[model samples]
Target: MRKNEDNKNIAVIYWSNSENTEIMAEKISNGIDETGQKADLYNVSQFPIERIEDYDKVALGCPSMDGEALEKNTFEPFFEEIESKLKGKKVALFGSYGWGNGEWMRDWEDRIGHTGARLFDEGLMIKEFPDDAGRHACVEFGKAFASF
Candidate 1:
Protein backbone atom coordinates (compact mmCIF):
# COMPACT_ATOMS: atom_id res chain seq x y z
CA MET A 1 0.00 0.00 0.00
CA ARG A 2 1.11 3.58 -0.58
CA LYS A 3 1.72 5.96 2.23
CA ASN A 4 -0.78 8.72 2.77
CA GLU A 5 0.44 12.20 1.86
CA ASP A 6 0.71 13.18 5.48
CA ASN A 7 3.06 10.31 6.15
CA LYS A 8 5.56 11.25 3.44
CA ASN A 9 7.35 14.18 5.01
CA ILE A 10 10.71 13.28 6.50
CA ALA A 11 13.75 15.31 7.54
CA VAL A 12 17.26 14.01 7.11
CA ILE A 13 19.59 16.14 9.20
CA TYR A 14 23.31 15.72 9.66
CA TRP A 15 26.69 17.25 10.45
CA SER A 16 29.75 16.13 8.54
CA ASN A 17 33.37 17.18 8.83
CA SER A 18 34.95 14.74 6.41
CA GLU A 19 31.72 14.58 4.38
CA ASN A 20 31.34 10.88 5.14
CA THR A 21 28.27 11.47 7.26
CA GLU A 22 26.74 13.61 4.53
CA ILE A 23 27.24 10.78 2.05
CA MET A 24 25.48 8.47 4.41
CA ALA A 25 22.67 10.98 4.76
CA GLU A 26 22.24 11.15 1.01
CA LYS A 27 22.17 7.39 0.76
CA ILE A 28 19.48 7.24 3.38
CA SER A 29 17.54 9.86 1.47
CA ASN A 30 17.90 7.71 -1.62
CA GLY A 31 16.41 4.83 0.30
CA ILE A 32 13.55 7.02 1.38
CA ASP A 33 13.01 8.00 -2.24
CA GLU A 34 13.05 4.37 -3.28
CA THR A 35 10.13 3.86 -0.97
CA GLY A 36 8.25 6.50 -3.02
CA GLN A 37 8.86 9.20 -0.48
CA LYS A 38 11.15 12.22 -0.28
CA ALA A 39 13.05 13.76 2.57
CA ASP A 40 14.41 17.26 3.02
CA LEU A 41 18.11 17.01 3.75
CA TYR A 42 19.70 19.62 5.99
CA ASN A 43 23.07 20.33 7.44
CA VAL A 44 22.68 20.87 11.14
CA SER A 45 23.93 24.43 10.90
CA GLN A 46 21.33 25.32 8.31
CA PHE A 47 18.36 23.52 9.78
CA PRO A 48 16.32 25.21 12.44
CA ILE A 49 16.06 22.97 15.46
CA GLU A 50 12.44 23.97 16.01
CA ARG A 51 11.53 22.89 12.51
CA ILE A 52 12.12 19.33 13.58
CA GLU A 53 8.59 19.44 14.91
CA ASP A 54 7.26 19.82 11.38
CA TYR A 55 8.31 16.45 10.09
CA ASP A 56 6.68 13.17 10.98
CA LYS A 57 9.99 11.37 10.84
CA VAL A 58 13.58 12.44 11.41
CA ALA A 59 16.86 10.71 10.59
CA LEU A 60 19.83 12.35 12.28
CA GLY A 61 23.38 11.67 11.09
CA CYS A 62 26.53 12.88 12.77
CA PRO A 63 30.07 11.59 13.02
CA SER A 64 31.79 10.92 16.29
CA MET A 65 34.01 13.77 17.39
CA ASP A 66 36.64 14.16 20.12
CA GLY A 67 36.46 11.18 22.41
CA GLU A 68 33.52 9.53 20.65
CA ALA A 69 31.16 12.38 21.15
CA LEU A 70 28.68 14.19 18.95
CA GLU A 71 30.16 17.05 16.94
CA LYS A 72 30.49 19.78 19.51
CA ASN A 73 29.54 22.78 17.44
CA THR A 74 26.51 22.17 15.27
CA PHE A 75 24.94 18.74 15.65
CA GLU A 76 25.26 18.56 19.39
CA PRO A 77 23.45 21.78 20.13
CA PHE A 78 20.82 21.03 17.55
CA PHE A 79 20.17 17.63 19.07
CA GLU A 80 20.10 18.97 22.57
CA GLU A 81 17.55 21.62 21.68
CA ILE A 82 15.19 19.27 19.91
CA GLU A 83 15.55 16.30 22.20
CA SER A 84 12.69 17.06 24.50
CA LYS A 85 10.44 17.61 21.53
CA LEU A 86 11.27 14.13 20.35
CA LYS A 87 8.85 12.73 22.80
CA GLY A 88 6.43 10.59 20.78
CA LYS A 89 8.34 11.27 17.56
CA LYS A 90 9.66 8.67 15.14
CA VAL A 91 13.42 8.96 14.77
CA ALA A 92 16.54 7.17 13.57
CA LEU A 93 20.29 7.70 13.90
CA PHE A 94 23.27 6.90 11.65
CA GLY A 95 26.87 8.03 11.30
CA SER A 96 30.53 7.28 10.62
CA TYR A 97 33.43 7.00 13.02
CA GLY A 98 37.20 7.08 12.66
CA TRP A 99 38.12 5.19 15.81
CA GLY A 100 36.80 3.46 18.88
CA ASN A 101 33.82 1.16 19.05
CA GLY A 102 30.32 2.55 18.49
CA GLU A 103 30.05 3.85 21.99
CA TRP A 104 28.93 7.24 20.73
CA MET A 105 26.01 5.74 18.90
CA ARG A 106 25.04 3.69 21.91
CA ASP A 107 25.02 6.71 24.16
CA TRP A 108 23.09 8.70 21.58
CA GLU A 109 20.47 5.99 21.27
CA ASP A 110 20.03 5.80 24.99
CA ARG A 111 19.81 9.57 25.29
CA ILE A 112 17.22 9.85 22.56
CA GLY A 113 15.25 6.95 23.99
CA HIS A 114 15.12 8.59 27.39
CA THR A 115 13.32 11.53 25.83
CA GLY A 116 10.55 9.18 24.70
CA ALA A 117 11.16 9.22 20.98
CA ARG A 118 10.09 5.98 19.36
CA LEU A 119 13.24 4.64 17.73
CA PHE A 120 12.81 3.40 14.19
CA ASP A 121 15.33 0.64 14.79
CA GLU A 122 18.89 0.05 15.90
CA GLY A 123 21.33 2.80 15.00
CA LEU A 124 23.70 2.33 12.02
CA MET A 125 27.39 3.10 12.45
CA ILE A 126 29.92 3.02 9.64
CA LYS A 127 33.63 3.29 10.23
CA GLU A 128 35.55 6.03 8.38
CA PHE A 129 34.02 6.43 4.94
CA PRO A 130 31.04 4.30 4.03
CA ASP A 131 31.82 1.74 1.39
CA ASP A 132 29.30 0.08 -0.89
CA ALA A 133 28.04 -2.25 1.81
CA GLY A 134 27.64 0.55 4.30
CA ARG A 135 25.84 2.76 1.83
CA HIS A 136 23.54 -0.09 1.00
CA ALA A 137 22.84 -0.53 4.68
CA CYS A 138 22.02 3.17 4.96
CA VAL A 139 19.56 2.85 2.12
CA GLU A 140 17.94 -0.09 3.82
CA PHE A 141 17.94 1.86 7.05
CA GLY A 142 16.11 4.70 5.36
CA LYS A 143 13.63 2.29 3.83
CA ALA A 144 12.95 0.71 7.20
CA PHE A 145 12.58 4.08 8.85
CA ALA A 146 10.20 5.18 6.13
CA SER A 147 8.17 2.07 6.72
CA PHE A 148 7.77 3.07 10.32
Candidate 2:
Protein backbone atom coordinates (compact mmCIF):
# COMPACT_ATOMS: atom_id res chain seq x y z
CA MET A 1 0.00 0.00 0.00
CA ARG A 2 2.92 2.30 0.63
CA LYS A 3 4.68 1.56 -2.59
CA ASN A 4 3.82 4.46 -4.85
CA GLU A 5 2.52 7.42 -2.85
CA ASP A 6 3.83 10.75 -4.02
CA ASN A 7 4.72 13.59 -1.71
CA LYS A 8 4.59 16.62 -3.94
CA ASN A 9 0.87 17.35 -4.04
CA ILE A 10 -0.09 17.83 -0.42
CA ALA A 11 0.90 20.66 1.87
CA VAL A 12 0.26 21.50 5.51
CA ILE A 13 0.56 25.19 6.23
CA TYR A 14 0.17 26.76 9.64
CA TRP A 15 0.80 29.81 11.76
CA SER A 16 1.42 29.66 15.47
CA ASN A 17 2.59 32.15 18.04
CA SER A 18 2.40 30.06 21.20
CA GLU A 19 3.36 26.85 19.31
CA ASN A 20 0.11 25.06 20.15
CA THR A 21 -1.20 25.31 16.61
CA GLU A 22 2.18 24.31 15.23
CA ILE A 23 2.08 21.12 17.24
CA MET A 24 -1.25 20.22 15.72
CA ALA A 25 0.08 20.89 12.26
CA GLU A 26 2.95 18.51 12.86
CA LYS A 27 0.61 15.75 14.00
CA ILE A 28 -1.61 16.22 10.99
CA SER A 29 1.41 15.83 8.76
CA ASN A 30 2.26 12.68 10.63
CA GLY A 31 -1.14 11.27 9.74
CA ILE A 32 -0.72 12.15 6.14
CA ASP A 33 2.60 10.35 6.15
CA GLU A 34 0.93 7.31 7.66
CA THR A 35 -1.30 7.15 4.61
CA GLY A 36 1.83 7.01 2.45
CA GLN A 37 1.46 10.59 1.30
CA LYS A 38 4.35 12.69 2.49
CA ALA A 39 3.00 16.17 2.92
CA ASP A 40 5.08 19.30 2.99
CA LEU A 41 4.78 21.30 6.21
CA TYR A 42 5.25 25.04 6.16
CA ASN A 43 4.68 28.01 8.34
CA VAL A 44 2.50 30.63 6.67
CA SER A 45 5.37 32.99 6.20
CA GLN A 46 7.54 30.32 4.68
CA PHE A 47 4.98 29.38 2.05
CA PRO A 48 4.57 31.55 -0.97
CA ILE A 49 1.04 32.20 -2.19
CA GLU A 50 2.02 31.49 -5.79
CA ARG A 51 2.67 27.86 -4.94
CA ILE A 52 -0.98 27.12 -4.26
CA GLU A 53 -1.42 25.36 -7.55
CA ASP A 54 1.39 22.96 -6.80
CA TYR A 55 -0.65 21.11 -4.21
CA ASP A 56 -3.96 19.42 -4.85
CA LYS A 57 -4.82 19.38 -1.17
CA VAL A 58 -3.82 21.69 1.65
CA ALA A 59 -4.23 21.72 5.41
CA LEU A 60 -4.24 25.18 6.95
CA GLY A 61 -3.77 25.84 10.65
CA CYS A 62 -3.98 29.06 12.61
CA PRO A 63 -4.70 29.67 16.25
CA SER A 64 -7.46 32.00 17.39
CA MET A 65 -6.01 35.43 17.64
CA ASP A 66 -7.00 38.91 18.84
CA GLY A 67 -10.68 38.44 19.70
CA GLU A 68 -11.13 35.11 17.95
CA ALA A 69 -9.63 36.03 14.63
CA LEU A 70 -6.74 34.59 12.61
CA GLU A 71 -3.26 35.69 13.42
CA LYS A 72 -3.33 38.95 11.46
CA ASN A 73 0.32 39.72 10.86
CA THR A 74 1.03 36.60 8.82
CA PHE A 75 -1.59 33.89 8.45
CA GLU A 76 -4.52 36.20 7.60
CA PRO A 77 -2.66 37.89 4.81
CA PHE A 78 -1.46 34.55 3.47
CA PHE A 79 -4.98 33.11 3.54
CA GLU A 80 -6.38 36.12 1.75
CA GLU A 81 -3.75 35.83 -0.91
CA ILE A 82 -4.48 32.18 -1.55
CA GLU A 83 -8.26 32.18 -1.19
CA SER A 84 -8.82 32.58 -4.90
CA LYS A 85 -6.54 29.68 -5.70
CA LEU A 86 -8.49 27.23 -3.54
CA LYS A 87 -11.31 26.76 -6.01
CA GLY A 88 -11.94 23.07 -6.68
CA LYS A 89 -9.14 22.10 -4.35
CA LYS A 90 -9.42 19.92 -1.29
CA VAL A 91 -8.83 21.96 1.85
CA ALA A 92 -8.75 21.20 5.56
CA LEU A 93 -8.41 23.54 8.51
CA PHE A 94 -7.22 23.01 12.08
CA GLY A 95 -5.88 25.05 14.99
CA SER A 96 -5.64 25.76 18.70
CA TYR A 97 -7.72 28.18 20.75
CA GLY A 98 -6.98 29.74 24.09
CA TRP A 99 -10.40 31.26 24.70
CA GLY A 100 -13.90 31.84 23.40
CA ASN A 101 -15.90 29.56 21.13
CA GLY A 102 -14.62 28.49 17.71
CA GLU A 103 -16.12 31.38 15.78
CA TRP A 104 -12.95 31.88 13.79
CA MET A 105 -12.96 28.38 12.35
CA ARG A 106 -16.62 28.64 11.34
CA ASP A 107 -16.00 31.89 9.58
CA TRP A 108 -13.03 30.30 7.90
CA GLU A 109 -15.15 27.40 6.67
CA ASP A 110 -17.61 29.86 5.21
CA ARG A 111 -14.88 31.72 3.42
CA ILE A 112 -13.58 28.54 1.83
CA GLY A 113 -17.09 27.84 0.63
CA HIS A 114 -17.14 31.16 -1.20
CA THR A 115 -14.05 30.04 -3.14
CA GLY A 116 -15.66 26.78 -4.29
CA ALA A 117 -13.06 24.66 -2.55
CA ARG A 118 -14.21 21.28 -1.32
CA LEU A 119 -13.72 20.87 2.39
CA PHE A 120 -12.11 17.62 3.46
CA ASP A 121 -14.05 17.80 6.72
CA GLU A 122 -15.17 20.18 9.42
CA GLY A 123 -12.60 22.35 11.06
CA LEU A 124 -10.60 20.73 13.86
CA MET A 125 -10.22 22.94 16.92
CA ILE A 126 -8.43 22.24 20.16
CA LYS A 127 -8.36 24.47 23.21
CA GLU A 128 -4.93 25.50 24.45
CA PHE A 129 -2.13 23.02 23.85
CA PRO A 130 -3.23 19.54 22.91
CA ASP A 131 -2.68 16.67 25.29
CA ASP A 132 -1.92 13.11 24.13
CA ALA A 133 -5.48 12.39 23.07
CA GLY A 134 -5.68 15.62 21.15
CA ARG A 135 -2.41 14.83 19.44
CA HIS A 136 -3.75 11.46 18.37
CA ALA A 137 -6.83 13.12 17.00
CA CYS A 138 -4.74 15.48 14.90
CA VAL A 139 -2.83 12.58 13.45
CA GLU A 140 -6.05 10.77 12.61
CA PHE A 141 -7.46 13.86 10.96
CA GLY A 142 -4.36 14.08 8.81
CA LYS A 143 -4.63 10.42 7.88
CA ALA A 144 -8.23 10.81 6.79
CA PHE A 145 -7.45 13.94 4.85
CA ALA A 146 -4.63 12.26 3.01
CA SER A 147 -6.83 9.31 2.22
CA PHE A 148 -9.50 11.66 0.92
What is the lDDT of every predicted structure here? 0.88, 0.90
For candidate 1, write residues 58-103 as lDDT tens digits: 8999998999999997888888899888887889999999999999
Clashes of each: 0, 0
In model 1, the worst 10-residue window by lDDT is 1-10
lDDT of 1: 0.88
In angstroms, give how far residue 29 of model 1 lies from its true place: 0.5
Candidate 1: where is the Cα deviation over 4 Å?
1-8
Candidate 1 positional error at 86, Å: 0.7
Q: Model 1 Cα displacement at 97 (Å)?
A: 0.3
The candidate that achieves the highest TM-score relative to the unseen native structure? 2
Q: What is the lDDT of residue 84 in candidate 1?
A: 87
For model 2, the run of ten residues with the poorest summed lDDT: 1-10
Q: Which stretches of candidate 2 lie over 4 Å from their true place?
A: 1-8
